[model samples]
Target: MGYGLAVLGLLLVLSGAPAPAQTRAQTQESNDAAEQELRLPPIGSPAAEAMARYAIEREKKEYRENIERAQEVARLSAELQKAFEQRHGLFPDDLRKLERIEKLARRIRSEAGGSDGDDEGSDLPKSLEQAVRRLANVAKDLSERVEKTPRQVISASVIEKSNELIELVRLIRRLS
Candidate 1:
């Protein structure tokens, strides 16, 4: 009877004993899981709501700024067209105007979630006159596209038009 009791106790002790390797691995995994859970606030929590609101506000502000930039681009393009009409060639401030247009176009593209796209070998203007006219037309079109695009939507057409306008501005700058 004493020997049988000793054997049963031994079996229970063995069963209860945790393997060192498995215990260590399980502990580490649980710790990592807990750390990951701590990183993000629970869904529907106040912290999550605040984070969402912040993101929405930031987007709204960016949209407003982009609209202003688009308006500026339109105004500058109109002025460039008028200057070209008056001077009949590259004006004194034509380079500056082209540079501004390029900068604005790049900003608009980035804000509209566009990357720098490759020039698709579109028909480039050859002469300074042709380049200036094309730049005006492209800039006007880009501005219109931006104004028409909704705040929540990223328009592929806006991105394409901005890229085209940027390329046209660069070409005009080179031609001048």
Candidate 2:
């Protein structure tokens, strides 16, 4: 009788234990349900429509801001180029322009999805004039690239160019 009772208790305990496969299936189902709950509403639903409109408006605003920053970069670079041509080297007063160019380039780089990181090595310009000229050319290229890129796109080339322009501006600032 004791042996039969012990066997019955063990059977009950074994039956109550959840099987690993069954537990995993339950967890997967729970995860799927949670994911479904977090998903966007179906297309044509009011919530979905509102989300779409908001996304479009936000994209348009970002696009306008990007264009403005790129244009400012071009203008500042051109001014630097002109100053160099006139004086043959940057004057103390021209440091402000370089600072502004650096600021604008930083903003443009961030907006284009770039992070502050060491740029790939390149030969440093031998003179202030050469650096300024390179800066002007790069700024122009950056402006054109930004204008050509669609609002929905994140451009690697634009980010690379911005980094290059920023480094040149910094080098010029330090040398001046």
Candidate 3:
């Protein structure tokens, strides 16, 4: 072989380019990388391992969730305001003034939440299907809390998007 070819052949033999052998350390490293990606705890650790647990916990029990929920409520309120303006050039005269409507909105929202702990499943009105869907999603999320591991995390930042959807539901209910 030529000098270059000789060197190439020697390098290929040393590198085992024709055949592959995975060392134990290389295998362990690959496994570790996978575990990290999955948020799995090490062989021996006291703390929780998975990120999903944190996400579920943060979304409900944390202040971040409350803020997000409050923001969603604000967005729904804005949409209702806009729809009212579009429909009647400001709020309806019979719906009461802004301040009173705000008070009623708070009362009703609190009542809705408080009523969740009660027997709401039996008394949901058939006419409020749209409202029920939105509220069902909220309940679905809130009910999925992590009991063992709770940490603050945010999911998808989807409150605004949900707000737009709920706005349509709120409008439908107001009309019905």
Judging by TM-score against the true structure, name the best candidate. Answer: 1
Between prediction 2 and prediction 3, the one with superior lDDT is: 2
Candidates sorted by lDDT, descending order? 2, 1, 3
Question: Which stretch of 10 consecutive residues in model 2 shows the poorest summed lDDT?
Answer: 16-25
Candidate 3, position 123, lDDT? 26
Flag regions of model 3 displaced more than 4 Å: 1-39, 42-45, 49-57, 61-176
Model 1 CA lDDT for position 151 = 86
TM-score for each of the candidates: 0.72, 0.72, 0.25
RMSD of 2: 8.3
Instruction: List the global CA lDDT of all models.
Output: 0.81, 0.87, 0.43
Residues 31-84 of candidate 3: C-alpha lDDT, one tens digit per residue: 899988977555345545355566666645554444444444454445545555
Question: How many Å off is the CA of 155 in candidate 2?
Answer: 1.5
Writing each residue's lDDT as its tens digit, candidate 1 over 28-125 gives 78889999987978889999999999999998898888988888888888788889889887766877877888889889988888877633556887
> Which predicted model would earn the best lDDT?
2
